[model samples]
Target: MCSRIEDVITEKARTALLQVLGPLPWLEKAQGEVRPTDQIQLIRPYKGGHELALARWGFVSAGMGTAALKKYAMFNARGETLSESRAFGPAFRTQRCVVPLSAFYEWPTVDGKKRKTRMSRPDGLPLLVAGLWNRCEGSEGTVESCTLVTRPPTSDLLSVHDRMPALLLSKDLETWLHGTPEEAQTAALTSWRTGVLQMQAV
Candidate 1:
């Protein structure tokens, strides 16, 4: 249900950070016009480490450039069914990615109403949520989009929602990003044990 995301970090900062991630061979190829259809932005890691990428709002390739749909799209993919769902199975198995966020917004319902809240790690570290992306063709054109992977909420987050985005730590980034298919599946199912998340009303 993470429909709106605030990417406060500027492009320059993102590029600078990416340079530290790893060698980015694609940066030279990233010349096309960025549109709603072009959802994934690739950044070169600073010193030729692992390249980092970000997904934009979970808008999948098929949904981009469509005029008929008006609803806020599904940005978070449930981890339980990620490998089985038709919409995400293939991407989950192969096109896994890491989504970096300062914080993410979730709505808590009360008495049949909803209120917005922001969730972040207690130490204010960027949350590296696991994601799956796909390149699909639509009537308008081809596009790449991604969905945030989600798991059962930790004890600290259960009061707000039953599920929370799959947040990976810096230590686990490599295995999740470049691990083999089997290793990736194992990583996706394992929850980040440290319930260091903090939330506040927004």
Candidate 2:
């Protein structure tokens, strides 16, 4: 299963990203909590290259209660099903965003024993995971939440799990965030094949 990754963004990483993804007032107010309407961050680093872009939080909705507990919390949507799934189709058509992380966590089960692994770039850069967002009205009030998109793992990620977050590159962030339906689909289907990500036992 996928979980929060460790390795803080720190002041340097945050400041660097802000310089690249300018005019992002929302990021100044961002904290670590996964709240509705909170700004999600995105950073894209190329293979053996510098970071491409940094984005502030976007919006998304999480399934509540039974839906959340049982149905994966809408944290990830399959890239292959973006054009088909009812819950994700609309978001795929519009409202796409990027999620930044220095690392992410996944649990591996070997011989009935579970082990946690931390995945991150070998060069210590950020990884950009594709995301979708939507606003929903709840009894409490209006909330915005987001879900990460997933696809078959790249060769580098297969040892950890069958699926990995759909990682986006700098060249495609604009299209993924503001492209037509077909463009979004093409961008989503592209494989994440940059930076050597390391999976260490945590």
Candidate 3:
């Protein structure tokens, strides 16, 4: 699963997001490494339009305080059991979002030794990773957290890791977020072109 990600949104992806959230006044155009608990960009589907939001990388429960964040790892949600999971089910059903990643970091064990690696699109396009986000009232303030949905790795990617982020095409991004839960599940398991995924030692 992806623990670290580089969100260097390319011009094309920036254009796509801008079309949804128009100007993104508060967005700082962050580039490079984004880890758990960090505020990352996400486009939330609202009633009238999309809201560009800054969401924490890990999902924080409403009943839990800030102290519990360090203890629980809710960064990556399993796609196989999304609907049944307490942490990610609700959000997966209604609060889905897209996570644009330039590349994701992974650790693959080869010959019984683990080595850090990075996965990216061979065409240099951004990976529109499927994700779920929610807002919880915290002691400090409202904490909006998001978790990346993960699925069994494609044949080629299994060599690098056992799982990879659920990446959707640019066209299917919004549909996965606003559509029904069944549609979201179908989108999560959609066949992806494995050849475009390039993995290399970081």
Question: Which candidate wins on TM-score?
Answer: 3
Per-residue C-alpha lDDT of model 1 across residues 1-202, encoded as one tens digit per residue = 4554433444543564455354343332233222232354433223435554544545464554544333545566777776578777777666777766666777888677887778766654556677776667777565556667788877777778777778775566777767775676566667476558777778
Q: Indicate whether candidate 1 or candidate 2 has the larger lDDT.
A: 2
Ranking by lDDT: 3, 2, 1
User: Model-by-model lDDT, in order?
Assistant: 0.61, 0.62, 0.80
Query: What is candidate 3's CA lDDT for residue 64?
Result: 78
lDDT of 2: 0.62
What are the clashing pairs of model 3?
Answer: none
**Tens-place lDDT digits, model 2, residues 149-184:** 877887777767888877776677767776787887
**Highest lDDT among the candidates is held by which one?**
3
True-vs-predicted CA distance for residue 7, candidate 2, Å? 8.1
Tell me the deviation in Å of residue 40 in model 2. 5.2
Error of 3 at 76 (Å): 0.7
User: How many residue pairs collide in each prediction?
Assistant: 13, 8, 0
